[model samples]
Target: MPKKVPIRKCVGCQERKEKRELIRIVRSPEGEFSVDPTGKKPGRGAYICPKLECLEKAIKNKGLERSFKTAVDDELKELLRQKVTSYEK
Candidate 1:
């Protein structure tokens, strides 16, 4: 039997898509934010599409903040933008 694929919602576009098709942003137990390419990192994770528009939408809509349940400051947001921009296709 085929393995069941996981599903994740993009914090950016708010779209429900297969987990593999999205990029994951993980907040480690130490409260560190980083991108999880493998999608298996053990921590709170938020997903976003591989698109710049979605990134902007997420920032503007406070989607990431809601997902992480914390205030995402300007520096962190800038850092996230840099990391996510590289992942954009």
Candidate 2:
């Protein structure tokens, strides 16, 4: 039998989903926050769906802040917006 894959929670919808189906946002040791396409970064992390709408929902509901336990700056929001746009393209 095939092993069941692990699922992760999306801060946006507060739902659990397959890890491979979501994008990972990571905080580096130096306190930098960025999207980790490779999902191999070493630091605190949060998962979200790759869809732009999911990102909007996450930001509007303060889900990212709740997951990271830190306020996300406007600059980071802009960066995330751009990243999600690129992902959608």
Candidate 3:
């Protein structure tokens, strides 16, 4: 039997991609945001590509804000940038 690969859409490009190929951002019930690498965090989640371009587009388009249903201000944006870069290493 063949196992099915999970698919998710990128909030930045709105493109469908394999789940393992993207990064996930989660908003805890307590309204805290974190970049989810293990993809096992319990919370509302939004997916984005790991590319910087996608991150920029997501920010400019307010994709994260829409996904999280909250204000994604400068501080959080900077945090996301740092976490993403660290993850890439």
Candidate 4:
């Protein structure tokens, strides 16, 4: 029998996918928002695809804000845009 892979829900599409296939956005213990490539950061976390489209969907739908239970400022959205765009390339 093969071992089952873990799945996580994407905050963007709200769909379940393999955990390794998604990017993690974390809110640190200090209440800071940032992307965690390592996926080991402390505090609240949200998952999304590395694709720019997914990030756009999440941003437009306020998925991150709901996940973090806080407002997502424009600065964070800009940072996320740059990061996801770079990742897609």
Candidate 5:
């Protein structure tokens, strides 16, 4: 039997995709947010596709803020942008 693949929805595109195909953004208990490439980090997580358009959409629609349930400052948003852009390289 083939292994069942985990599925997650992208906050940006609202599309269902395999977990491995999305980047995970995790918010620690201490309220620190970071990208989790391994998808094993503790705390709340939000998934987004590895594309700039998705990232922009997520930002514009406040998807991350809704997922994290906290205000995301501009600095953090810029940091996330950097991380997402790095993944494109």
Candidate 6:
């Protein structure tokens, strides 16, 4: 029998994809937000594609904010941008 791969939806593209193919954005219990490369972080998580366009679309559409149930400030948005850019490299 083959193992089934986990799937998650990209907040930006609104497309279902393999979990490993997506980047995780986590909101800690303390209300801190960061990109989780391992996808094992404990907190509220939102998945997104690794592309910059997806990141931009997520930001523009307030997808992260909606997922985290908090207002995503500019600082956090910038940090997410940096993380996504670094991941793209």
Whole-model Cα lDDT per candidate? 0.86, 0.89, 0.89, 0.89, 0.92, 0.92
- In model 2, which residue pairs have backbone atoms overlapping below 3 Å? none
lDDT of 6: 0.92
Evaluate residue 47 in candidate 1 and report its C-alpha lDDT on the 0 to 100 scale: 90
lDDT of 6 at 5: 98
Superposition error at 47 for model 3 (Å): 0.6
lDDT of 5 at 64: 90
lDDT of 3: 0.89
After TM-score superposition, the amount by which residue 76's alpha carbon in candidate 2 deviates from its true location, in angstroms, is 1.3
1-89, model 2: which lDDT tens digit per residue?
A: 99999899988888899998888999888889998988899989999887788889999999999888888999988888888788787
Error of 1 at 64 (Å): 0.3
For model 3, residues 4-73, the per-residue Cα lDDT tens digits are 9999999999999999999999999998888888999999999988887788899999999999999887
Model 2 TM-score is: 0.89
Over 4 Å off, model 1 = none
At residue 77, give the lDDT of candidate 4.
86
Worst 10-residue lDDT window for candidate 4 reads: 79-88
Per-residue lDDT of candidate 5, residues 1-89 (tens digit): 99999999999999999999999999999998888989999999999998899989999999999999998888878887898898889
TM-score for all models, in order of appearance: 0.87, 0.89, 0.90, 0.89, 0.94, 0.93
- The segments of candidate 6 whose C-alpha lies over 4 angstroms from its true place after superposition are none
lDDT, residue 18, candidate 5: 99
Q: In model 4, which residue pairs have backbone atoms overlapping below 3 Å?
A: none
In model 6, pairs of residues that clash are none
